[model samples]
Target: MNKLSLTRRAFVTSASAFGLVGASGLALPYYSRANQRPAFTHGVQSGDVDATSGMVWTRTDRPARVMYEVSTTESFADAVRLAPLDTSPASDYTVKRLLTDLAADQDIFYRMTAADLSDINAVSEPIVGRFRTAPASKRDVRFAWSGDTAGQGWGIDETGMKIYSTIAKHTPDFFLHSGDTIYADGAMKDEVDLPGGGKWKNVVMIDGKRKVAETLDEYRDQWKYNMMDKHVLALSAICPTFYQWDDHEVVNNWSDSKDLTTDNRYTEKSIPVLAARAARAFHE
Candidate 1:
């Protein structure tokens, strides 16, 4: 396997687009799922595709060396293995790699595995994703775009982000998330009263989602909670999502002049400081 020498700049550039379960097979809310073996806690994703290149991303439960392979077929019989990339606490155990020299306008199957840095034998079961590269010549191209996910206290319920599945039905080349990807300031309750004599239940509510995000980990949780949805995970695996951020990624109506004096949930009221924290979480 040939290792690609990655620069810090490259990793920062790829963090905007970000995956599924492997080995543990415990599904999502990976926070509760722990074991000695490394697991692909989040699924795999591919995006930022061009005629001959694209980006792929995934996250693990702990420090590990993530390996990669790409195939034109789903069975992966002709998979070309690439050298592993080490991930650690520095990146919160998340990593993305840019793949180049791919054939234009073709179906690409990517497979990934993780070997615990501390125990190489404790490797993970593979996870896979599919994407198509841009065409070299003129052709019909399709893509989807949307934003404002898991916001306004509405969260993943039993229905599980049905709209994402609807988007995947079109089989777009990629997805553009326009912004407000996570409502970090919007707190959630386990249940919301409905006007129609029923209750909107948030079946899985983590502590991070219970209140407004103030800490860096809390902000990160906002993204993690959205990915816990099956539909989001499904779309992510098959289509690359290019992410953008709005004020919500930091705080509501965030700006250099934004105010937090009236808000009591935050102990640190400095907009500059808070926005800086949010920016890091957004990049990751």
Candidate 2:
């Protein structure tokens, strides 16, 4: 492997092996699941592109070894295969592989393969995606920005995040998700009362859809639920993304000094403690 590839692989390997260590000497647990055939439930996403590198992300329904191949050609005749990586419960079966040493100002096609351990011969159908590298030299670029998904009682519907599809139609080089990527702090009711005396329908997935996220699992589930939108998945497959976080990701306008006791939705009164957990989930 080249130095870039080696560096990427080493970082992931070490992280998987040691977990996230904190100043207080506490180690964050890695997510894991019972053995089963691997399945790509959430599709794929590419983001954080530069002249020579980018990040690809995916999630598997079970524990498995994730492999990725990238190429400039659609057929992948001259593809570069990265080192294989593993997914466990620690990451909630998510895998993010970094691709490096890529040509600048070029379109790249990539695909992922998961080898299911429950059955040694079982392998998943490839999940394909594409992205463009940033230009080595200064050049004009086009991109789009949006945020606040499943917010204000408007949850994901079968139509699948239609706004994202509309944005994708413009074919921007990338997308800037400006915060509120998820409303882990907001509740989505099955039927929401409108300001003008009408009802807005929402496709509810769970009973606690109206509760604020308190546990780590709840926060993770909020993300997983948002990915269920097909349009969102479709947009991600083609557009690289630069993601930023906003208050709704934890609580509305939450800060280290904010008081949670005033908010009935928050069961945890400690803003600092909740912020720490929220930050952890956001990074993962």
Candidate 1 C-alpha lDDT tens digits along 184-219? 888899888888789889987777789877888887
Candidate 2 residue 169 C-alpha distance from true site, Å: 1.3
Please name the candidate that would achieve the greatest lDDT relative to the true structure: 1
Which whole-number lDDT from 0 to 100 does residue 120 have in model 2? 35
TM-score of 1: 0.83
Q: What value of lDDT does candidate 2 attain over all alpha carbons?
A: 0.76
Q: Which residue ranges in model 1 land beyond 4 Å of their true spot?
A: 1-35, 256-260, 264-269
Cα error, residue 124 of model 1, in Å, equals 0.7
| Candidate 2 positional error at 189, Å | 1.1
Model 2 pairs in collision? 30-90, 31-89, 31-90, 32-89, 32-90
Question: What TM-score do all the candidates reach, one by one?
Answer: 0.83, 0.82
Q: Which ten residues in a row have the lowest lDDT in candidate 1?
A: 12-21
Q: 138-248, model 2: which lDDT tens digit per residue?
A: 888999998888887788655657988898899899999999987877767778788979776777465435677777777887787777888888899999988898898
